[model samples]
Target: MKTRKAKEQIVKELKEKFEKASLVILTNFDGMTVAESNKLRRSLKEVGAEYKVVKNTLMRYAYPGTPVEQIKDAFTGPTGIVFAFDDIVAAAKALKEFFEEKDSKLKFKAAVVEGKVADVEMIKQLASLPGREELLGQLAFTLKYPVNAVAWSLDNLFQKLVTVLENVKAEKESA
Candidate 1:
């Protein structure tokens, strides 16, 4: 049995986490082996997320008076939460990939992002998004395309002018 002070500390930590996390995913980790769970933790760590098992009661205590209260009921049955404070999409994508590759029984129950409770379909969509670096690179390329096009157009115009001058010189010589 946990002492009152210990429970309070845990609740305090959980409440702080709930307030700060950008994304919170609840999952049912019923049949996953310890090794598989560890692997999932490592994968989440790679993307700067954390995975931990929490008691339903404790979760309720932590979430009371917070935006996370909406997901308090989903804390039932072998609940493990992945909290992403850095990159929400990366955390979801990494967890989804790990679950897919391992074929483990870890099932996503619900997710909350930016204080809004997200359904399963929304969670899947979030998971489908490319990682942070990839998205940044894509945005950068998109922003750079117009600049590149203008540069190419200028180069083509200069080439045309040179070509016209060369043709004029050729005509004079031929004449």
Candidate 2:
């Protein structure tokens, strides 16, 4: 157990991170083993997220004035928090994948994503979204497709105009 001063320090840091995080996922890890928890932490870390098993009391202390307040009720029963400072979708996908792979007592409680309160269902939906890089790549392809089509059409039009001009020049030269 942490001392009173340590707990206060944790709460203060958590509050500051809660303010900065793009998304905070609250989960119930009621029956998760240490190994399983470490695996989950690794998975989350790969996606630019930090996973912490915080005391509910400490979390409560950290929650009141931040976006985490929206999901304060979830801070009960073996609670773990996943903080996504970068890509929320990648973080969500990592959590969801780990949860499904474990098939244990792990369960999502709630989340605050981009200042919006989300339930487990919404979190699952978020997990299904493409990652930031994938979405950006798709957008780039979409934008490039139209530009390439326009360039090709313009090239064809120019070639046809040149051919017509060449034919007219030939006719005038013959006359």
**What tens digits encode model 2's per-residue C-alpha lDDT throughout 1-175?**
6788998999999999999999998888888889888988999999899999888878888988899898877777889899999899999999888877836667888889999898888888999989999999999999999999999999999999999999999999999
What is the overall TM-score of model 1 with all chains considered together? Answer: 0.87
Candidate 2 regions with alpha-carbon error over 4 angstroms: 1-3, 173-175
Instruction: Give per-residue lDDT, candidate 1, residue 113.
Output: 90
Candidate 1: which stretches are off by over 4 Å?
101-103
**TM-score for each prediction?**
0.87, 0.87
lDDT of 1: 0.89
- Steric collisions counted per model: 0, 0
State the local distance difference test value for candidate 2.
Answer: 0.90
